[model samples]
Target: MDLNVKITVLGAGAIGSLWAVALKQQQHDVQVWTRSSDSEYSVNYQDLNGNTHPLLFTANSVEHLSQSDLLLVTVKSFQVEVALAPIIKLIPNSCLIVIMHNGIGSHEAVKALFSNHCVFYATTSQAALKADAKLQHTGNGQTFIGSLFSANSSYNVLTEVFNQALSPCYWQDDIMEPLWKKLAINCAINPLTAIYQCTNGELANKNYQAQLIQVCNEVTLVMRAEGYRVKNDELYQQALTVINATADNYSSMNRDVFYQRPTEIDYITGYLIHRAKKFDIAVPVNTQLWQTIISMESSYHA
Candidate 1:
């Protein structure tokens, strides 16, 4: 929680850049590691007063990332393994590795690689992006921090650190609940909105509304079969509320698909489809969405 604490942010993409700026604003010794070897990194950020601040920070390579108290991994879920491979040996055993990614399985992957170190999981509703080297914070939301299990001391310490660095740091007893909750939201809203190239509000149309409800219903059944308690109507309402709140902005999945880049479908809806197969459960709606997105990606490339 001290400003003297050295923090190294891995994967200086949109989310990572916003965090680096916020920590720097609080006077924390923060440095960002990116895939590129560029010396200067620029990010566009807006303060509480709605003033845009473009920050340019000195960039460092993986070789220069050894001197940090905490390492925040903000890479896309698919790139987590590759990004961490180069820097894992340089990280000291005392430092904590915080992973902020969508979907599941990231923590297990990191834990398997670094068996002796502390790894934490964090989820946030905060939305951000990079515009010509400027990291822009598009929307504000709360962030939850904790370990995989309950009654862990590391959860409290990490919660305090996040609270000092960002606003509304919530500590939960079971982090998986919120993680799955957010994943469910992404499963329903992301692919549908991306495929149609429409804002969240556009889902309110009668035709799209019926399709949205069906998707949520199928996902609800999958979650319940997995022994997770989630009401279909409640989750559907939450998804609709989020769509309305950020109705004007483009969902991240849409950006990826539009730019001919690989999306995180394998992590979001695909993760569920994988689990459903393991349990012999039916998830037709999710399966359809997953296949549709994959086909879209294939068509975009072809």
Candidate 2:
């Protein structure tokens, strides 16, 4: 059965804009919630063949938040708390909140509040690049949906919405595998890109290959510690696959650093460092990566 739902996407970055437009195209009532008022709520949808289509949508402030059947939290990993603080209160427990962003811990932050609203975690390779006033859809990637803790009544409706309207998506009984795997790749790619000031594929250069491998190895060990099936070599190769696939794109961290904004280093590399400490495992490489990124942030922000 097809279910009609009102969805509010709470973020106006590249990915948020992409999902907002994509879901709206599917005939769902989708509204966007950004931090402030922006008249430049436009996006260029570039199809696989390089065809571009302009999409404009309704954008509202946090104060204007009305009831929606679902809320898609698409802010940066670190911005989740502030972004949803006021808006979450406006949302009812009956509303389902789905978080789609890079890295981890956002869901846990919400779970810490002990809210009764259904919460789910999502990861997507869907690539969108933000320009002056409009975001460009650079790539079409699949969206992966997973439960934050347990699947709830909204799972079927959310799954059906994506499966029927949005891009290719799946519901996982245990999303930790794919989530961790994606995390492994992000830890290897995003921070390094920020430090090196290069595109994803630049890491493929022989000079940076060792650093990439070390990061991969450290992440794999942590993933294994958490009981996920992970092989360092296999993850290394998989990371390469992601790099080749999105070779020209700058990582979110790279953008954050370049723009002198706060990066999600704490959630990505910082989270990995915390996990390593739990197992009393030495992740000197991850530690150094985290410190390097943090130091760069301080110097740049200062």
Candidate 3:
């Protein structure tokens, strides 16, 4: 399709590095921006099958951002605003912006901040983690994208570029359903796994089955109140399916809490709790999990 554009990845973390390498392999002009003043120009990428390759990126310069046609943001949900505030003016107004992160809420903030640009939301199941200068592709999953603010933008170019770089990228007319579903899965599995220091599979055990169902029920109530047609049973079953699918791997929240790093519990469960309060809905279970994670985060330094 001869798709070539100047793409700038706003974060050099695991997810950011994964896509940076994938897009560069597709021959796009890819550069990365990191929080550190001293960062590498290349990333050591390890594919899903454990094949390691040295991938190079363009110079991380302010001028490159001005010429960027697309900005793919892969930062944590909480750091979205802080990371983009500095470089937001450097990027062209006409550039297509895609914020692909774990949880919700960041899309609204970005849409409001970048009012002139077409902001899109992407939810991906593809997992990766960073170790020093190396990025490991832990799992392969599809990507779903849809427009959050601008509905008239050209998605064909984005679909082709993303699909070729990372296969199975689907364009959805209503991306919120899939995004909420992903959040449902995260809400049900992530906190329990983190608290218990267990893998995803352990959530399927009898000991945790009731707790999992309660979490899903609370999330389903909030979802329906927020205008989504989600059922409690269906959400519970979906969580079970995910628990079986990624049985061995620990969730991102689990890893974050284990490493004493800040987790995105705020965006995942916190977003739901906020909506629940808006509708006068009771989400006690979700609230407890959110508070527990917040408590855990507080004890990170103690």
Candidate 3 per-residue lDDT over residues 1-302, each given as its tens digit:
24788899988888889999999988898999888764447778999889999987765688888989999999899999999998888989878898988878887678778988878888988878788888898888889888876564468678778899998898877788789989999999999999999999989899998889999998888888778887549999989888888888889899999999999999999998888889999988889999999999999999
Query: Candidate 2, residues 52-99: lDDT per residue as tens digits?
Result: 778776677443355677888899888888887776668867677788
Instruction: Candidate 2: give the clashing pairs.
Output: none
- The TM-score obtained by model 3 is 0.95
Measured with C-alpha atoms, the lDDT of residue 48 in candidate 2 is 55
For candidate 3, the lDDT comes to 0.87
Clashing pairs in 1: 42-133, 43-134, 43-135, 44-134, 44-135
Q: Give the per-residue lDDT of model 1 (tens digit) for 1-302.
A: 34466888888877898889988887877788888888767776775457888777767755446767889999989889999997789898877888898888666677788787777788998887676666667788889877773357644766776777678889876777788888888988889988998876787677888778888887787778878888659778988888888887777788888787888999899988887788888888889999999999999847
Task: List the RMSD of every prediction in angstroms.
Answer: 1.8, 2.1, 1.7
lDDT of 3 at 27: 86
After superposition, the stretches of candidate 1 with alpha carbons farther than 4 Å from their true spots are 1-3, 61-64, 149-151
If scored against the real structure, what TM-score would every candidate get?
0.94, 0.93, 0.95
Worst 10 residues of 2 by lDDT: 58-67
Error of 1 at 230 (Å): 1.6
Superposed Cα deviation of residue 267, candidate 1 (Å):
0.4
Q: How many angstroms is residue 163 displaced in model 2 relative to the true structure, after the best TM-score fit?
A: 3.2
Local accuracy by lDDT, each model: 0.81, 0.80, 0.87
